[model samples]
Target: MKDLGMNLALSAEEKSLLELITPELVKIGKDRSKLIPILQLIQEKLAYLPGEAIHMVADHLSISPSEVYGVATFYNQFRFNPPGRNPVKVCLGTACHVKGGDIILENFERKLDIKEGQTTPDREFSIERVACVGCCALAPVTVVGQTVHGHMQPSKVEGLVLRARIEREKQQREKQKNESSE
Candidate 1:
């Protein structure tokens, strides 16, 4: 793939990812209309859109990198950074707002030491604010992973963060145990 004059030096992992996705890119064809599909495919495989993948897509479609970035950013479904093992979504709907959802969100930020839309350095947790989680009756809600937590209070943030860490550690240990058995 052409670097488009960016002179990017891809690491071994990036090169491997590019190699894995190149065939799918070819099968999907290079029409401009396929840009979104190409990006989706890459994101599906990599869990996020990396800069190298963006440049490759731009080059493949004969489009500018800025154009690709514009489209990607326009859609909230695309994530530029890798998602954390545990995702925490704080709802800020009208009901949640009235119930102090903002405070709950801030508590999570302080406890996680990362702002909304960012993942922790260890990739353990990520926090984001959502307009609504459709659980207004359970206003002031935070959803960790797939589980919905209702009636959230600022005081609960530490417990929630701690639970997520414990869960992740347990999962890791299980994975390691399985690997050893194999």
Candidate 2:
């Protein structure tokens, strides 16, 4: 496979993941029509598509990296960056907007120190803006992972972030304890 010379770097874990998925990618076929399925497989394996993996897929299909990226970007299901342990989605639907959803979203940006569609440096949290969460009654809502939090306000941002941190810490500690027991 040819390198696109983008000089993208993959972490040890990412490299290992790519190695594991490469065989499947090849078996799926190298035709350009197979691009979407290949990309889907990669995302399913890695949770998000890494740049190195994108380039490798392009080479495998005898296409340019941009071609792969273009197709991937066209689909909303694809994500280029890694998702955080806690993914925060702010609803900006018409009802939520009227209830000050933008303000709530801004408060989260300030508290998290990361803009929409970006993950924190520590990877503990990621922020995204959603068109709607289908809960107009709870306008100005924020969903963290699978839980829907309603009637959110700017004042509640700090507490929400703090709670996520505490929960993440607890999970980490539990994971460590389990590993030690093993």
Candidate 3:
């Protein structure tokens, strides 16, 4: 819903994200050296940069849009498009792979109706593969949100997705409650 091509008024969500980072942003002044922090703040706020936001940030910080976009593109953590509510990361380390992590990943793809690096149609979930998470002692680990489930079996995919969906709903409810109070 963000039009990345135009300079427009900030939405409520955009303003909330800005507010969350204002303290850190205030520490940064007009110097171009702050470009990295500015980009980082934006990325952390929205998970990605709306093309229009790049220009907005550049103007606010007195820098170049090209510079903002360059930094945005350079970082793997910064995405141009919006990501799903819950990003699912599956560890595929050598130990995990040997313990059937590959099958577990495939199981997730099938059950979630989305492939690795792709988000579901409803944008509820996004799946990704990680090289390692240093949890090899518990090989075959899958992380949904911040919860890590070790020694995963292919059959556990449905439950993992279900738990993620439930958590997202709970988070959404909490967000709505806070918004209503505001």
CA deviation > 4 Å runs, candidate 3? 1-11, 19-27, 61-67, 80-85, 100-103, 113-123, 166-182
lDDT of 2: 0.84
Candidate 1 C-alpha error for residue 33, in Å:
2.7
Which of candidates 1 and 3 reaches a greater TM-score?
Answer: 1
Write the residue-wise lDDT of candidate 3 on 95-121 in tens digits.
999999999999998998766766666
- RMSD (Å) of each candidate, 1 decimal: 5.2, 4.4, 5.8
Model 1: per-residue lDDT, tens digit, 40-64? 8888887777788888999999999
Positional deviation of residue 181's Cα in model 1 after best superposition, in angstroms: 9.1
Winner on lDDT between 1 and 3 is 1
Best of the candidates, lDDT? 2
Q: Per-residue lDDT tens digits of candidate 2, residues 1-182?
A: 22222233455887898899878877888789999989898989888887888888988999998888888878888877677778999999999999999999899888888777767777778788899999899998999989999999887888889998988889999999999999
Models 1 onward score TM values of: 0.79, 0.84, 0.62
